[model samples]
Target chain A: MDVYLPIAEVSVNAPLLLALGALVGFISGLFGIGGGFLMAPVLVFLGIPPAVAVASQANHVVASSTSSVLTYSKAGSVDYRMGGIMALGGAVGALFGVELFRLLRLLGQADLVVAVSYLLLLGSIGALTLKESLTTILARRRGEPARREPTRRPLWLYGLPFRVRFPRSGLYISAIPPLLLGVFAGILSAIMGVGGGFILVPAMVYILRMRAAVVVGTSLFQILITTAVTTVLQAGRNQTVDIVLSTLLMVGGVLGAQYGAKASARFRADEMRAALGLLILLVGLQMGLSLFLRPDDPFALAPGGAG
Target chain B: MMVPPGPPPMDPPALVAPAPEPPGPVVVTQTPTISAALTNSEIEVDSSYAGASLVLYGAVFNPGDDPVDVVLVVRGPERPVRLVRKVRVAGLWLNSRPVVFEGAPAFYVMASTRPLSEIAGFGVLRRMGVGLDHIQIDAPDEARTVNLYGVRDVVISRLGEDYLEWRRAVIRLKERDGLYRADPSGVRFVDPGLFRAEIVLPPEAPTGEYRTEVWLFQNGQAISVRRNTIQVRRVGVERWLHNFAFFQPWLYGLVSVLLAGFTGWAASRWFRRT
Candidate 1:
């Protein structure tokens, strides 16, 4: 069925949108990460305006992360002290990022900036994840135990001021690192319309040396807050958030995530990670190649700019 | 009143008659008059709206048997359009040199009984803005008025052919989007002087007042013209949401956030129960 989205001012197939949301949601749940990076780009490709796609998908992130965070909080896996500090930094960063996005839009460089950022970030991350996962898988196949990550914290983390103890994660570290990491995640979320969990989990594990048990939970908590803020800001300032579109995506995402989470228990971790890495790499490559390829039409038209 | 004649002949009179009659004294008759009306004056765009097609039925009142062609031009609301040209910059395509058209119609579709070229002379069609090529799209920065031999003439500076490229790009892009179109045989004559044309508004049609001009052409001249309007606006939930987003953006944002949070919480509870 076709439905006209009010804010985007376009008619789109409702079932198609729901299916897209469900597919992305399933991937996110299987990988234990928010799927904003995948959803936003797909929405753009499906004919939603770039800005609207970015903003509206942020709302979907909020719902998915909220549910995940609730489960984590119930299990007492979340580090509130750490997550709160990061969320604070994220809020400020998200506000700044939204304003910057608005300025880029006025300059007519928003789409270029978005595409370039996605190409670079996704390409690098995907390559690293694939290489690491493949190395582990090959080592296991050769009858060797999986290599462990180093537990030692970086020296600079100790050197920073404002040190605080996180009881849940059982860590004593300077608060600045988590705060800065949160700010980075917040900026990324606002610009790329993602929850930034993929980046945050690794950063927390390697940089802050937080416990693995609490890392995912804390990251989800931070993402929930930051994306909520981003959604509100994008809607208020840019008027690009389409609630109807978001709702359709959320309904499918919520159901799909549950099933995906159930299916994750049957799969090996390294293989799943490798598959996700390959998928991300392919998407990144496609977006990157589009910039170099000759366009069908060199001219584009948009309304609402000053004449 | 003269029995509203029958459906038009299949072939043009010129094709069937090879000989021309000797010139005779002109017999002046009643001036031709045209009237048109849309089947629906107001098109409500609800959530189910994909696109809309309206029937524009009209009639030309001419006493004599002089053949006349029907032409209809449907123009949607005017909007300021920014045209961007992508330039290859250091191996990556980037948008550069944006040209702004102050007032360009969001939707423009011209339908006629016969091809515009065959119905009228080039000058007549151009002057009447009968086809896509004749439509005026002006860029303020590239246009100026200068006095040539004591007579003021409005001249459009071409900016060395680059500006013209942007102007044509606007039409080309709009055409690709199905917003601007020209159909040579879109108008059908139900009876000799009665005609009907279908105006199809695509899903991307801008919502506002659409002006449709019906022109009656005879002997390469527009003898009669009639104008009508169509109002396209969002209705029901669509209108409410659009107005809320634009008028009370902050509140709407808050509502969106709250709704998202609630949905998340509800999903968690539902899954937990399951």
Candidate 2:
């Protein structure tokens, strides 16, 4: 059956969208990522306008992260104090990013900018993850100890003012770093149309030195707030959010995530990470190559001014 | 707004006193007349709407014994469209040289009993906008008005031949999406002086007012013409959602967030119990 999207003004196969959402959701659940990064690009490939795809997927992120945050809250793994500060910064950053997105959209460069940002960010992150995981797996197979980096806080991090305590994570750090991290993730979320969890998880682990148990929950908290802000701004200013499309995706994502979580238990951590890294690399590479490939039709059409 | 040239100005009122009537048998010739009506005047685009086929039945009167032909043209609402040509910039394809077409019809469909070329000459068809090739696509920003020779108010594009390429590109792309089409034999004569045509509106049809024109062709000239309108509108939940997003976007956004949050919460609760 076909479902017509009001905001996007496109009729798409309902089952196709549901399946796409499930596929992305399952991967995200297996790898413990937000999956917005995967969903946005695939939506564009399915012929949804890039702007609509980007904005609509942000709504999906809001739902998925909210669910994860609730689960984490139940287990008392969330550091609300830290997450609250980060969300404040993230909200402000999201406002700025949404305005920037609007400006790029008017200039007709939004598609290019979104595609290029995804390619660069995903490519580098995927390469690094793949290299790290491969090395760890090979070392274990050769009966060698996996290399580890010495844990040390940067001198500048301690010098910063406005120190705060996050009792749940057992960390007392300057609030400036966490706030800045949130702002960065928020900007990335708005521009790249992602939940920013892939970047946030590692940053929280290595930079903020937050405990692993608290990192995912706290990041989910930040994502829930940031993506919510982005979705509203995109809708109010750009009017690109398709509630119908987002609803379909959320339904599929939620269902798929449950099964994917169960399936994750069957795979080893290193092997799973390796698989995810390769998948991300391939998606990024495909997007990057399209930029240089000759298009079948050189003329592109838009409904409004100079687009 | 450019319109199909109307019937050559009704033979222009005679300026000089009419000459004394020549003595002869005054045989009155009947003028061909055409009228049409759509089966459904309004097409409602609900959630289940995929596409619609409209039946237009009409009749001809006083269509003298000159073997008259019927032609139907439907044009959807006009909107500004921009066509951008991608160019290689810094080793990447980027949009540039945008040509903006003002007042371009979002949908166009032409149907006739016979091939347009066989029914009328090129000049007549061009003047009447009877065929796909004759539909005027104006780009005001890229064009200028000038008087050429004795002709007044001729619009010419600044890009010269490049403008024609852009115009063709617009039609080509619109055709690919089934937005613009022409059928030489789409109109059928159900009976003497009675005719009907079927217009197929694809799922991507834009919502707005549509104008349908019926023309009576005789001796390779359009002797009679009639026009009617149809409306394509979003109805039911589709209309509500569209209006809500455009008019109350902030509230809609808030509602969207709340709905998603609730769904998420509910999903989590459901899984926990299992």
| Model 2 CAPRI quality | acceptable
lDDT of 1 by residue, A1-307 (tens): 9999998778999999999888887886677677898898789888788788888998888887777777778878789899999999889889988988876665556768777877887887788788888998999999998787777888998898998988888788888988888888888888889888777876786678787778877888898899899998998888989999999998888777666766876999789879878887777787777789888899876433422
DockQ of each: 0.40, 0.36
Segments in model 2 whose C-alpha atoms lie over 4 Å from true places: A303-307, B1-29, B61-65, B141-161, B190-192
Cα displacement (angstroms), candidate 1, residue B30, comes to 3.0
Estimate every model's Cα lDDT from 0 to 1.
0.80, 0.79
Best by DockQ: 1
Look at candidate 2 and tell me the lDDT of residue A235: 87
Docking class of 1: acceptable
Tens digits of per-residue lDDT, candidate 1, B1-274, equal: 3634333322333222322222364333354556788999899999998889999998776765667888999998888676677789999998763455657888999999999988988987776677898776656655554443232342323355577677788889989989999999999999987899999999888899999888877777776677778999999999999999888988888898888888878988998998
Which candidate has the highest TM-score of all? 1
Point out where model 1 deviates above 4 Å.
A303-307, B1-29, B141-160
